[model samples]
Every structure is written in C-alpha cells, then in structure tokens.
Target: MNYQWYPGHMTKARRMMQENIKLIDLIIEVVDARIPLSSRNPDIDELGKNKARMILLNKSDLADERENEKWQEYFTQKGFHVVKMNAKSGAGVKNVLPVIMEACKEKIERDKQRGIKNRPIRAMVVGIPNVGKSTFINAFAGKACAKTGNKPGVTKGKQWIRINKNVELLDTPGILWPKFEDQSVGAKLAMIGSMNDQILNLEELSLELLGYLHKCYEGILAQRYELEESEDRLAMLSAVAKNRNCLKKGNELDYAKASNILLEEFRNGKIGRITLEQA
Candidate 1:
C-alpha cells in the first residue's frame, strides 16, 4: 500500500505560520504519544527555531505508559519542556501553566528588566492533523475555544486565544509536509487515523497493523479476538472477522468490517496501551 499524505491546505498553513512566527515568543507543540517523532512536522523546528519550545505528548493515556516516560525524557534531553497529557479528559492539564512559565522564564526576566510587567507570553500551538492541538487548547483554556474532531483537518484557520493573563495561544491548522521522507511514518500516521479514511485501502492497512501487533505485541490479538495462533497476518484478520461476526450474505468474512474494527480499536486503545515507535 502506498502511504501518501494529501497536502490539502498545508502549504497555506505553513505560510500563515511563517507570517505569525515573528509575533510569537514560544511554541507549544503537541504530538501523539504513540508516534511522537513521526507526528512532528520537521518544518516546525525551522519555524520555531529562535523561540522557546514545549512538547505536549497529547493522548498519553492511550500510549504505553513506560514509553511515554521515555518520550518525555527524549524530548527533554533535546531542550524541550515536555508534558504528558490526555487532552480529552484534561489529565495532566494543570501541569501545563507551570511548565509554560518555566519555558519562558528567560523572556519573562528580559521583559521585567525592560520595564514590562504582566505581559502575556504569546505561544503558537502546532502539530500534524489529529495529534489533538485543538483539544489541548480547549482543555488548557477550560473551554471549547477551538473545534475538534476525531479525524484530521478539523481546524481550517488561525485563532488567537488567551489562555490566561500570563499566556496567550495562537492556534494553527495541523499541517503535514508534501512528502513523507520515510514511508513508514506515513503508514503510522494513517494507522493513527491522522489521514482521511475515505481515500485509504483499509484491508491492506489492517494487514500491516496485524503484522505489527503480532510482532511487537504478541498475544494481543489472541486476547482481543480469542483466536488460536496464526503466523499469517491475513489469517489473524480473518479470525478477527469471525470473532466480530462480520459476515457477508454468503457467510464469507467481511474483511472491510474487520479492518475497520481492528483499526478503530487500535486507535481508541481497546487493543491496549501500545506505542508504535521507541524513543
């Protein structure tokens, strides 16, 4: 299967970010805890080069707990103030303000010396689609300030929201680069439902997902579907189909229904707290 990310309005989003970067003092980047590095757009590093940076590992609740800690350490070692959070439930939300203050402490001190007081820190929130940028903003602000959906490209334009008297947020649409340098990254993004499902070949994608789960997380399928052992990924998917009662008119397995179930369960953490990559 070819893992292609349709660019959509990403080019325009990049332009908007470039135009607004200078007006920003800090960047609050959100990434999926399951695919931290893959979910990150490389353009952000260039766009936010001179600014203070923070990495919010959104949806950390759905990822492997041990891996989440490692990801926090990994990003911290690279000079980003990191927070592991679940934006939907607002878990770990309270930790954000203190860390934001710490990340922008230098700028705050500089402003104090320049006779500026109570100047809110302007931060640009960024991430690839479906990494939960809008949800994070809503949770952080304790209100529905930005629109959020399960799939990608929900946010279409920029919105500036005051998170507090000390910090304000600039919300930008999620953007992915035109081409994925590693096709695996694209595949991972697709598995996480970051891409539009209408254009994808779900059966092929489910097979790939089955292969990964059988390798990295053995017994997961057996436990979830109560299936006997099968080395073949397609066979495992068939078992999922039978277990899910996804049968067609002729009693043949509905691979498409099984595929959707597998992918959706994986995304929603029903398969377990699994991480796609290691730090």
Candidate 2:
C-alpha cells in the first residue's frame, strides 16, 4: 500500500495560507476524530509558527468516546486547546467560544494594554476538505451573523463573519493536504473515505478494513453481516458476499459489489460507530 499527495496543490495552498495568515490572531484547525493524525497536514505547524492554535476533533460522534478523550489529552499535553465536536449536529459547539477566548487570551490582553478596545479576535478555520469545514462554518456563524466586508488597506475582497463581539471568523477556510508518506496512514485515510476512491482497489481495501476491524474490534463482522469471522481475510469477505447476495449476471458471487456495499456501510455508519485507529 503506497500513496502520493499532490505537492503542486499543497504548494499553492501553502503560499495562499502564508499570505492570509498574517492578518489573523488564531488558527482554528479541524481534523476528523476517527483518523486525527492521518487527516492532519504537519506543515501547518511550520506555517502557523508563533500563532495560537486550536484543534477541533470534528465528527467525534462516530468515534470511540474513550479514544476521543485520550486524543484530547494527547493534544492538550502538547499545548494545543483541543475540543471534541460533531460539526454536522452542532453538538459541543457551545464549548468552542470559551476555548477560543482561552486560546487567544494573550492577544486580547495585548489589545487592552495598547488602549485598543472592542477588537474582536480574528481567526481562520483551516482543514483538509470534507473534514466538515463548511458544516462547521455554517454552525459557527449561524443565521443572524453579519459579514464584515473588506476594510481600507486590508486584502481585497476579504470578508469576515462577526461571530459575536469577542470573535470574528474568516469566511473562507484554509485548505490543507493530507499526509501520504506512510502507507499505513494512506490506508487509514482511504478507509475513512477521505481519499479519492478512483485511485483505490475497493476489494483489496475492503480486506484491509476487515483486517483492522478483526484486530481492533473483534466479532463486529459476525454481529453486523452475520458472517463467520475467519483468520483468512478473503474467506471472510466471501462469506459477506454470500450473506448479502452480491451476485453477477451468471449467478456468480460478486466480490466487487460486496466490497462496495461493505465500504459504503462502514463509511455512512450503517455498520456501527466504528473507529479505524487507536491511541
């Protein structure tokens, strides 16, 4: 299992991010809670040097609660303000305001020291696409919020959504690329449906998923699909196909159809609330 990310796209995004980063006080980064490390692009640390950072573990409702706690502790230990949230449902959204204030306390105090009053903490929401950035922005900004248009000497056509008196969020989110150096990381990203499916072998990918579930979460197969769990990965997949009646024109069992069904079920949480990785 090998993977390659678009360096050209990343380079362009980095340049744009560098240009936009100077105008902001904090970087609110979002990552999928199921594959926290894999979904993150490490270049953000260098790009956002000396800036206050907050990590929102998005889509936490589908992940293991215990692992989510461990991940929060891990990020906090490294000096990042971490929040577990389900951006789609707006769960845990209320907690972000105080954490934002906490993350940018120094900047807020600096404004007061300089006789600057009522200055909102400017922030940019950043993340890899499909990690719930748009959904979060909608939830965070809500219906009644106003967009502060471009000001004199500011970047042309820049707009900010005033999210209350204490904070104003950038209308656009900074896009980051996924890490594809490690094969395992790539596999994990694929399993979570973050990567493009066109480049993947669905049957092979399904087997890899089965392997992980068999190890991390035993008996999930027997319970969900009514298939016998076996040490042989292909045999388990065949059983799944047989149980689901995934067949082709000649009445032959179609592993590809079964693979698609399995992956889709897992991705949409039809199988269950399962997390692919652990602490």
TM-score (all chains, Cα) for each model? 0.98, 0.89
lDDT of 2 by residue, 1-279 (tens): 565444345456567678889999998888889888887778788878999999999989888888999889999998999999997789998889999999999998999999999989999777665577657766887763322211111121235678888898874433445446578877877787766677789899999998888888899888988987878999989988988999898989899999999999887777777777777
Candidate number with greatest lDDT = 1
**Residue 38 in model 2: lDDT:** 81
Candidate 1: tens digits of C-alpha lDDT, residues 64-182: 99999999999999999999999999999999999999999999999999999999999999999999999999999999999999879999999999988999999999999888879
Candidate 2, position 6, lDDT: 48
Sequence-dependent TM-score of model 1: 0.98
Model 1, position 156: C-alpha lDDT score: 92
Candidate 2: worst-modelled 10 consecutive residues by lDDT? 147-156
